[model samples]
Target: MSDLASPPLRRIQRIRHELHRRDLEVTRVERLSPHFVAITLHGDSLANFRSDSFDDHVKVFFDDTPGEPARRDYTPRSFNVQRLELTLEFALHGSGAASDWARQAAVGQRLVVAGPRGSMVIPVDYDWHLLIGDATALPAVHRRLEELPPEARVIALLQVDDAADRRLFPEQMQVQWVETTAELQAAVAALTLPEGEGFAWAAGEASAMAAVRPLLVAKGLTKEALKVAAYWKAGAEAFHETLEA
Candidate 1:
């Protein structure tokens, strides 16, 4: 476990400090929606793989012919310990190496992925939790829901291109869906949060989420209780493990 003061976003970094490199075989592929695809990976190496944080990201590498491999960061949606299965979801909105690969991914294909390295495990002690992001962040949001206690109260505000992209969660969770980035920002700005100590997590377009950070802080969410990040930026091709503001 480690801690780092990452400027605006003070991070409670918990990293394994070790990397697991594996050649995984694709076992299943499904299109959950027109804009989202889910891929399941299975391999012996997945045994004992630890993904303790809902927001943990693994580095995925793809074949690039004779050159260096193409790499992208993805959240591990679910991991079945008994079956040694790991699932990943991809958003197919942009034209890029990762997006193109996701569009054509199929069973029997091999993929190489490395470390979640470390996880920032958020304690489920808050009176309520708030999740905000675009379609790309649903996997993490869903993971958090699944991991939280049944009595946990959650509020999720998501932005997606279509209503069909909306995700289902525990009945205790209140979900609001919006169609555009601007709508997402407006909704957060005007949010009437539940009472008590609350935590807010936001991930999406860098610029948009950057604008949202201040509002959350001003809205009474302590600096220690807010986790805001830019999942992706417009016109960017490469992916860093952690988003920087």
Candidate 2:
């Protein structure tokens, strides 16, 4: 057979690999903190999943019952795709499909997952950036700060559980940590924004974001200047949607 007419060897291998790689069981679960649960699954099939500098999330599959499908979006904490190992942190909210699953998830349980999908990657070249949100948006906020090159001015307003829930980020970054005891929206609203170029990114509760959206716009930020998402809702199940309105 002519070389051009024959099937490529690499293409053949990829097709074969695709047949075997799909989903795996939950092999391990670790409690990273009181508020977070890091569940690691075998990474053999997901070896190609790559983390971007900004935000990346996956559609986590769950079985709430027979014949009824339930799915929720989750962010990967860390992953070693080669080793088939990855971790996902779940904020224990005591409700929602994801939070409930993480609350009761155990080693040996099975889960179906798909995609790091697309990235909400925001470059740090802005004159200044504001990361405002509650606990749910921590993963995105942390990733953004770490990915930013040193000497870049950035500020984050994070509402977490006391000091224990506060995370350490870049040395040059300024953080305003609010305990979860206070209202999530009010905490972010109280921030004294330093006068400068601001590209704000906020996520977490939807209603709170609804209020804050225009507040930032009124402060001279353009309508498209902010990137906001609601990872979940107060009383809804598996609520995951963009809060751009």
Candidate 3:
């Protein structure tokens, strides 16, 4: 008998950043959809800012609250070193300090943002990619799609309240837009993973992500091949966690 070939190793690199608390001013705001707002912030502090991962999160501070500032995690949608600007997308789910602030965010308004702290850089050489989540994951998913080569194979399962919320991607990319978390889970369970080494990434409501994590593993994905995160939780404030098997 001949020895079997080992699967290609997928290495995820982690890099730490020098934490800086930046006082940034809102330079622009665009309503991407009924429930999503894109805000571009600019400041001198961002001159050396680096976010090497699509899913890197920064701490956004809201001082509107009477007590200590309310802090929340937000994904860096995009950044331009030359312009010293960083773009962040806020998902407005009716309520929450961040949501409220984004709902009325205006140019010239100052905000304090701190550490992405570190980045976990996932390689893009995988045979296929699976992205699953709700509107909250849009920034990461969208950024990833943009970063990937046009030839990359990707299937994105996104849950959005309205069709207008969906963003355009490469025509070759398969995007399944669902309206509910239940649909999102069903879509994942029914997914037929492509043959070859693949990576799965998911984020959204905590409970929903908890339910979807095992399905991916059951579909022949090892713990090392997938990353699932709880971007937010129902009835809980400032919640974020990465689920591990």
Candidate 4:
């Protein structure tokens, strides 16, 4: 077994070594869904945006206007260097800074975005794959689903505010949703995994992920097979770190 069962610590090291890894550039933008927008970001400087693995997210900085406190960490939904085009998916919650910015961002508008910073590069040859997330994490999850090998068997748990939040994905992924509000840990714990030697991924709320760790462990999945990140916290305005056990 590898000394580091997961790549998170290594990824953090990569971020520390190079926080401003990619230069920020805003190209074009479009609304993808009622709640999601696909922003086409461009940067001749982004020519070196090297990321071949899935779920690679970046720290995106958005300011209401220039010289203000820029706040946001966004993941590119899809990008291609050959075309010098990168896309970001935004969730319109009428809440966070990023959400509000994305919901109202216009073309010719500029914002600061950064990083692949490095990601959890799971081996492509793993068994079954499981993805769990809410609206905030959909972009990261959707990007991975489309990028994974065509034959991958995936079981995904989606938590949304209501039925309207339910959406579609490109690949053959079985998605189950739990209509929920605040408490998410129990809902996530109730998710059924797909058959096979599966690898699990969960992101979004900290408590939910905290709840997931033990359940996954109980199901006989190794710590390596699971990569859970708490992207935000309840009632917190900024990015909050995950509370580890």
Per-residue lDDT tens digits of candidate 3, residues 1-245?
11111244878899999999999999999998888899999999998899999979999999865788999999999999999999999988778789999999999999999989999998998888889999899999999988898899998999997888888888899999999999999998888887778789999999999999999888767777889999999999899999998
Instruction: Rank by TM-score, highest first.
Output: 3, 1, 4, 2
Q: List the residue pairs that clash in candidate 2.
A: 42-84, 43-84, 43-85, 44-84
lDDT of 3 at 161: 79
TM-score of each: 0.90, 0.79, 0.95, 0.82
On the 0 to 100 scale, the lDDT of residue 190 in model 4 is 62
Find the candidate with the highest lDDT and give its number: 3
lDDT of each: 0.82, 0.68, 0.90, 0.67
Candidate 3 residue pairs in clash (backbone atoms < 3 Å):
none
Error of 2 at 183 (Å): 5.1
Worst 10 residues of 2 by lDDT: 8-17
- Candidate 4 residue-wise lDDT, 1-245, digit = tens: 21122322212112221445445456777766677778887777777676555566677766656676556666667778798777888878767678877777777777666776666567655556778787878887877877778888777787888566577875577777776633455655565555455677877876666676676666655655666777777776666454343
Candidate 1 has an lDDT of 0.82
Residue 111 local lDDT, model 3: 94
